[model samples]
Target: MNTNSTEYRLEGDGASIQSLPKISLHDHLDGGLRPQTLIELADEQGLEVPAADADGLAAWFTEQSNSGSLVEYLKTFDLTTAVMQTRAGLARIAREFVHDLAADGVIYGEIRWAPEQHLARGLTLDEAVEAVQEGLEQGADDVRHQGGGIRTGQLITAMRHADRGLEIAELAVRHRDRGVVGFDIAGAEAGFPASRHRTAFDYLASQFMPVTVHAGEADGLESIRSALFDGRALRLGHGVRIAEDLLIERQDDENTYVSLGPVAQWVRDREIALETSPSSNLQTGAITAWGDELVDHPFDLLYQLGFRVTVNTDNRLQSGTSLTRELALLSDAFGYDLDDLETFQLNAAAAAFLPLDDRDELAELIQDGFDEA
Candidate 1:
C-alpha cells in the first residue's frame, strides 16, 4: 500500500493536502488490500490469480473495475476475498488497511466489510470480528509508537441479497463495545431494496444501533426513500443518485431556480451525510445521467445547496485512489480551496458514529490541523 512520495498539493496555494487531518466514512475492507500481500496470500493458499506480479495485479483490478459493468466490476472481489479466508490473512490485511489510511492522513475511519463473506474458512461471525479488531488495535499502536494518532471503527455490513440481515444486525449489536461502531447493508442495490430487511432494521432500531444503508448508487429515489423510512439510515453510501430529485425550473444570470422533491428535502433538511466517492462513481456509471466526467458530478451542486457532502474513497484498490487523491480530484473539478477541503473534513467529523464529545474533539483537531496547514 505504499504510494508515491510525491505529495498532492492544493492548486495556487501550494499547500500539501496529505498533511491535513481527514475522516473516511465509506471505505471497504475487502476492497483495500495491498497487491503484494494479495499475491503472497494467494500463493500461500495455492489459489490461482490473474497476475503473478504486483504491478500486473494492480492493473488487472483497475481494468476490471473500469469495465462499466457492475457484474464485471464485482468479479474482482473474488480474488481479494479468496486470500482472506484465514485468520492470519484477515488480520494482516486489516492491519495494513489502517496503516495505509494513517499514511494518507486519516485521523478517523469507519472500515465496512461483510463478515458473512469471510466465513468460508470456518471462522465464526464473532471470531472474524475479533480478528479484525485485533489488527486494528495493532495498527493503531504502531501509529502511536511512530508519534502519529489514528482511531478507527468497524461498520459491520450485511449483504443485501442474503437472508442473514437479522443475524448480521444482532452480530453488530453483540460486538458494539468491542470495536464495532455501527451497522450497514451493502451489496447489489437494484432489485434488493432496503425494505427486504425491515425485520433487521426494526431490531436494530429497538437496540438503538446506528445504521447506514447502501442506496441511490444502483437505484433511484424510491430506494433512497426506503432506506430512510425502512432502514432508518443515518447516512447514505454513495448516495449520489439522490440528486435525481432536483428539478431545474429555470436559470437566471445570478441564480438558477430549482425545486426539491420530498426525498431531497428530507435528506438536505435533516443533514443526512452523503458519502460521495468521485472516481468510483464515474467508473460504475453512477453519475452517467448527469454526464461522463467529474465536472458533471452533483457534488458541487449539493455542496452549494448546503447538503452535507463528504469525500471518500469507496474502494482504494478498485478505484486506484486514496483519500488525498480524492480530495485533489474534487478540488480540481470545482475550484475548491483549503477552506473548502476543511469544510468537507469537518462535515465528516460531525457525521461520524462517535459520541458527541468525541465528535467535538475531532472537529477541533481538524480545525487545528487545517489552520496549521
Candidate 2:
C-alpha cells in the first residue's frame, strides 16, 4: 500500500486519488478563490474584508456557509465578487482557479461565474467574458509549461433572480468559440423558477447551445421540472433533492423496494447528469430531507439506480475541499473503490459541454489514467 495524503487515498490499495484524472462540471469561479489571493485582492481594491488574514477569512466563509440556508450560504460571495469587479482581479482569479484545479488532478473543468455580477466597476458583459477567457488560456499555457495538462472552459452564468437571463445567454453564445462552453442559471433557486428565463432558454435551444440549470438543490421536484422543460438544461447542478421524488416502499438487508416519480424517472431514463457536491450540499441544506451527514446523501442511491451521477466541488474554498477531497469523503461514506471513482469521472466526462469527439477523447484519457493506477 502506497499512501501520501491519507485523506485522499483509496481504502483498498491506499492509492492517491489526487493523482487520478478527473473532470469538474459544477465548480463556481468566485466561490473557489484562494484565500491569500482574496485577501490581497480585497486589500488592493480597498474593500473591507470579513477577516484580516487568509486563514481567518476562510474560517469565516465556512462558518457563514454552514448556516444551513442557501440564502445565507450565498452571502459569502459578496466579498469574493466585490474584489472581482476589475478585469485584473477577474483574470487573476480565473488563472488561479485553473492552477488549483490542475493541482487537484482535474484534467478538464468548466468554471462558472456570472458576468453581470462583475459589471459594477464599469466592465461590460463582453469584457468580463473575454477577461476570464484570456485568464483561462494563460493558466492552461502555464500548466503546459509546468509539464501538466489541463483544459478549461467558462460556463457563463445568469443570476436567476435577476432580469438579465437573455442578456447573459447571449453573452455565452457570443463567446462560444472563445472560451465559453455552455450557459447556466445560478443564484437563488426558490422564488425564481426557470420559467422566468423561458425566453433565454428558448433562444439557447434555437442556437443549439447546451445548458445546465441550478435546480433540485434549494428547491424541490417542481424546480427540476422547470429546469428541464423550461430551461432545457442538459444537466442539473446539485440536483440532489430529486431524491424527494423517490418513494421507498420497503427495504431489507439484501434488497430494497422503491418507486420513482415521473420527474425522477425522466431524469434517470433520459440520463441527465446530477452534479452532486456533497459537502456544499450538506452546508446549504440541500440534503436535509435525508440526514445531516455525507452518508445520508442520495448520490449513491442515484448511482445505484443508474442515474448519471457526477461528483463535483461546487465551491472549493467554502467547503475547504478539492475534487480529490470530495471523492475521498464520498468513498469513505459509501465504501467506494477505484472503479466507483472511475465511473464518476467517466460520467462527468460524458456530460461535459464539449463536443462529442472531445468528450470521447476525455473518456479515453480517463480510462487510460485509471488503468495506469
Candidate 3:
C-alpha cells in the first residue's frame, strides 16, 4: 500500500483521478488477497499452489479466470480460502487487504466475505468474525500511522447455494456491535434466488439489519424481484441485468427514446445501488446481453438514465485490478471526469449501511478530500 512520493496522477493536463477520494462498497475479502500473502499462507498450511512464485501465481489466476465461466473463475478462491482456514491466515490477508485499499485512496470501504467458508480449521463463526475484525482495525491503524486515512467495515456474507443462511444472518446480527455492519448473499444467483433464504431474510428484517443481495448479474428480472421482495435488499449487487427491463423504442440524433418497465422504474426511483464491476462483469458474462467488451457495458446507459450505478472491483486478484484501475478504465471508456468520480463516491456514501449521521459525515469527508484534489 505504498503511494509515497508517487506524483499524483494527472493525465494530459486533466485532474488526477488517483488523488480523488472514493468509496468502495462491494470489495470481497478472499478475492483481494495478495499473491505473496497467498504463497506464504499456503506454505504455512502445507497446501499446494498452482504456482511457486508470486508473479507465476498471479499469472495462473489471470489465465484460469479468463475462461469466462463464473464457476471456473470462482475456483481460484479455493486456493485463497484454503490458506485462510486459520485465524492467522485470515488476519494477515484482511490486514493486507485494508492496506491495499487505503493505498489506492479508498476513504471508506465495506469488505464482504462469507464466514461459513472460512471455518474449516476448527474456528467457530464468532471466532472467525473476531479475527477479521481484529485485522481490519489493525490495518486501519497501520494506514493512519503511515499518514494515510481510511475507514472500513465488514458486510458479512452468506452463500446463496449454502443452507446456513439463518446461521450467517444471526452471526451478522450478533457481531453488529463489534465490527459487522450489514448482511449480503453471494454465490450462484440463477436458481438460488433470495427467496430460498426467506427465513434468514425474515430474521434480518426482525433485527433491522441492512441487506445487499447478488441479483440480476447471473439471472434476470425475476432474481432481482426476489432480491427486493424476499431478501429486502437495499442494494443490488451488480444488478446490471435490471436493464433487461428496458424497452428501447428508437434512437434519434439527440436523444434515444426508451421506456423503463416496472422493475427498472422501481429500482431507478428507489435509488438502489448497482455494484457494477466492469472487468469482472465482462469475465462472468454479466454483460454478454449487451456485448463482451467494456464499452458494451450498460454502465453508461444506467448512469445516463439515472440509475445509482457505482463502480467496484468485484475480485481484485481474479480481475487483476484495483479501484484506481477500475476508475481509470471507466474514464478511458466513457470520458468521465473528476465530477463523475465524485458522484459515484457520493452515491456509495449515500447507500452505505452506516447510520444516517455517519453517512452524512462520510459524504462531507468525501467532498472535502475530492475538493482538495
Candidate 4:
C-alpha cells in the first residue's frame, strides 16, 4: 500500500485499517471526488466553486454537509454534480475513485450515483453509464499497475422525488452484463418514500435485479417499512433510525435490556444488511436519537443485537474520510477490536449485489486479509 502516513489509520495496534481488504457497499460516486479534481473540472467547465483552493474546497464540502437537515446537506451534491456533466468528467472521477479505494485497501467496491443527475450536459442515460463503465474498467487496470487489485460495480440510482425510477431501473438492467450491478432510489425520504416508485421496483423485481435503498436516514421506521415492503430493498442505506424501534427495558451492572419492536425484529430476522456510515450519519443527524457523539451511535447496540451492520463511508470526500477513517472513528468511539472490524467487512461482502460465486470469492479475500491482522 501507499505509505502516505498522512492518510487515515485505525486506532488499533493490530494493523492499519487502510491496509485491510475492505469492501465499500454504499459509497457515492459523485461524493468521493478529490478536491483538486473538482476545482479543475469546475474551472474547465467555467462553473463556480465555493472554495479557492483544494483544502478550502474540502473544508467547504464537510461544513456544508454537517448541516442538520438532509435536504440542506444534499445541496453539496449539486456542486459535485455540476462538473460531472460530461463523459470525460465521469470517467476521470470514476478512475480516481478506484485508485483511492485501492490505496485504502478496498478490494471490492460498488460506487452508486444517479444517472439522471449527470445528464445535465446533454448526455443520454446510456452515454453517462458508458462513461462510468469506461472509468471503472480503467480504474481496475490502474489498480493492477499499482501492485493492487480491486473490482468495482456501478449501482444506478433514481431520485425518489423524480419520476424516472422506471427509466433508471431499465438502464441498470440494461447494463447488468456490463459494469452495473444493482439499482436504488435516493433523494428526499420523508414524503417521497419508495412506495412512490412502486412500478419501478416492480419492474426491477421482474427482472430479478438486486436492490438497496436509502431509507431511514432522513426519515423514521415508516420510511424504512416502505423501503422494505415496496422497494424490496435487500440492504438499507443508513438504517440507523431503526434504533427508534428499540425500547430500553433495563440496565444492570452486567448488561442492558432492550426490546426490539416489530420493525427491528423483522430486519434482524431477515438479516438485511444496514449500510451504516458513521461520519455521514453524524453529519446528517441519522443517529441524533441516540446522541450527537460517535460513541452515542447505536452501532454497538445494533451489532450486539445481531443486526447485519456493515461499516461504510457514504461520502468520502464530503466527510473528508476513507473507509479506514470511518472504521477508526467507530473503533475509537465504541472500543471495537479487530474482530468487530472483520465482522463488518464480512457482512458487507455477504450483502454485496454480486453473483454467488463472486460473493464467495470476496468472502475468501476478506478472510485472507483479516487473517493477516
Candidate 5:
C-alpha cells in the first residue's frame, strides 16, 4: 500500500517485489531493531555501543553476524537487548518494527522474542508481553490511519540453553487471547534439542497451542526429528539443514534424480514449511553443508521437490535485508519469477498459526496483491 519504489525488484520484468503482500514467520524482535533507535536507546541507558552513528552501528551488526561463528553472531543481540530492558524501550522497538514491516509490505507477521532476556530491569513477564502488545496495536492503528492494513502476533520464545521452557510456554498461552499466537524455542540447536524442553512441549501439546521450533539451522536431521517428535512443532524455523536428507542419486543437464530419506520424506509429505532466510542463512553459514553462496542454498532444490518453502528475513537488521531483498536475492540466484514469489507467500500464509478462515483470508489477500502486481 506504500507506493514508494523499492530498490529490490524482479530481475527479468522488474516488478516491485517490495509492494507485494508478504508474511514474515521467522523474524526476531531483538534482531530487527533500527540502528538509529539502538543508538538513542543506548544513549538513554548510558551504555557503550560499538559505533558512534547509525550507519556505523548498522555496519557493525552486519560485520559481527558474518563472522562465521554462531556465538559471535549472537553477541550482536547483547547490544540490542541491552537497551530493551524497559517498557518504553520495548514498546518503541515493537512499534517501529511494525512500521518497518509495513513499509516493506508485510501484510502479516509473527514477531518472536524471549521475555526472559528482557527481564533484567525487573519487568515481569506479563508486563513485557503487555507492553509489546500495546506497541503492536498502536503500530497497526498507525498503518490503518495511513490507509494500509497489517496484522501481527507474538511468538514467545524460550531460550534453548535456558530452563524456562515451561514458564515461557505458559506465558504464551496466558496471552494467547491478547496478542501471543504461538510458542517457540530458539538459541543453540546442536546439543540443546527440543527434547530438553519436553515437559513444556508436552504441556503446550495438551493445551493445543501451536508450536514452531528453531531446528535444522545449526544442527542436522536428528535435531529436526526431535523438534517434530518431542516438540510437536507445527512449523520449523529455518529448517534448511533438512536438506541433508536429500540423497542426490544422479544429475543430468536438465534433470536431477534424488532419493528422499525418511526425514526428508516426512517433512515434504507432511507439508512442513521451511522458513528459509537467504541472506541470514548465508551469513550464519547455515548453508555450508551445500555451499557458501546463496546459489548453493537448497531452496531451489526443495522448491522443485515439492517441499513447502517460504522466504523470510530471520534478522532484518543483522542481515541488512528485508523480505523483499531476500526474495530478490533468491530470484537472482534461482531465476524465480513473480509466480514463484507468490507461491512462497502463499506457503507462508497457509502455514501461519492463525485459524483456517484467517489463513484463507490471507491467501486471498496475497493472491489479489500478486494479481495487481
Candidate 6:
C-alpha cells in the first residue's frame, strides 16, 4: 500500500486516530505485504512480477484493484501467494504483517488466509499453520522488545469455490489451542452458499468452534441467510448487503420512516457483527446499490439502526488502506467523533472470538486508550 503518509487525526480536535487502540477482524494475511518485501520474495523464487520496483508495484496494485470488481481484485493475490509457497516466505510475510499492524496502532488482529492455497510448495496443511504461528510469535516478540504490545490470532479460511471445508474446519479445531482462533469461508460468494459446507459447519458446531462467513458482499440476503442458518456464522464478513433487507418507507425534510425485513431485524436484534470494509466494499461494487461514493455507503445507515457494526480493512494491499485510514474515511464521510470511533472498536471487541474475560479486557483497553487520547 501507500506507506509514505503523515499521521491521521480527527477534523476538529485533531485527536490522533493512529494513536488510538484498534482491533482488526477482517484483515487478510496475504493481502497486507509490504511492496518491497513482495519484490524480494518474488525475486528469491524466480517469480515474475508485474512491476520492477516497490513504488511501481504499489501503483500497479492500486490501479488494478480499482476496477470495481471482486474477481479482478482477487487476481492480484496470485502474485502474493506465488511467492508465499515456502515456509520461509510465509513466515517472513506474516511477521511483517504483524509489524505493520502494530505500527498502525492495532492492539489485536485476527489474520485470515487459506492454507490450501499454499500447499503447492510441498508443505502439509499442519506445517503451513505451524509456519504462520511461528511468524506471529516472532512478530509479537519483536514488538515487545520495542516497548510496544500487539496480539494476533489466525482465522483459518476455506475457499468457497473449493471442496475442502470439512478438512479446513478440522485443521482450525486442531490448532485452536495453538494460535487458531476461528474458522471462515471466503472466495466467490455468488453461487457457493454456506449451505454447501453444511457438513463442515455441523462439525464445527459439534466442536463448539466459532465461525465468520463472508456473505452479503458478492451475493445478497439469501447468502447471508445461509451463512447464519447453515454455516452458523457468529459474524458476517463484509455483510454490507443486509441493507437490501431494509425498507425505506418514506422520506421528508427532517425524518425518514424505514422498516426492516427479517434478515436485517435478526442481525440487529441478535447483535451479529457486520465486519464492514468501506474501501473494499466500494472497490468490489458491494455498495453500488446505494451509490458510488464513500458518503453514500450504508455504513452510517447500519450504525444508525443499531446494528453491531465494525470497521475493517479487508485487504490493505489491495485497498491501499489501513485500519486507521478506514476509520478516518468513515469519520470524514459521516461526521463522526471520538465516541463513534470508540463504539466501533467496542463492537469489534465484543464480537471477537476470544473468551468473555478477554473481550472485556479489550473493551477496557480501548476505552482507556480513547480517554487518554
Count of clashing residue pairs in every prediction: 0, 0, 0, 0, 0, 0
* Candidate 2 residue-wise lDDT at 92: 93
lDDT of 2 by residue, 266-348 (tens): 99999999999999999999999899999999998889988999999899878877899899999999999999999999999
Q: By summed lDDT, which 10 consecutive residues of candidate 3 come out lowest?
A: 1-10
Per-residue CA lDDT of model 3 for 61-121, tens digit only, reads 7788776667777888888788888888888888998988887889999999999998898
Question: What's model 6's overall lDDT?
Answer: 0.94
Q: Model 1, stretches more than 4 Å misplaced?
A: none
1-373 in candidate 1: lDDT tens per residue? 3453558999998999998999999999999999999999999989988889988888888988997655567778888988988789989999999999999999999999999999898999999999999889899999999999999999999999999999999999999999999999988789999999999999999999999999988789999999999999999998999999999899889887889989999999999999999998988888988998999999998999889999999988898889999999999999999999999999999899999999999999999999898
In model 2, the runs with Cα more than 4 Å from the true position are 1-7
Q: Model 5: which ten-residue window has the lowest total lDDT? A: 1-10
Q: Which scores better on TM-score, 4 or 6?
A: 6
Cα error, residue 178 of model 6, in Å, equals 0.5
TM-score of 4: 0.97
In terms of lDDT, which candidate is strongest? 6
What C-alpha lDDT values do all the predictions have?
Answer: 0.92, 0.92, 0.89, 0.91, 0.92, 0.94
Regions more than 4 Å wrong, model 3: 1-13
Model 3 lDDT, full chain set? 0.89
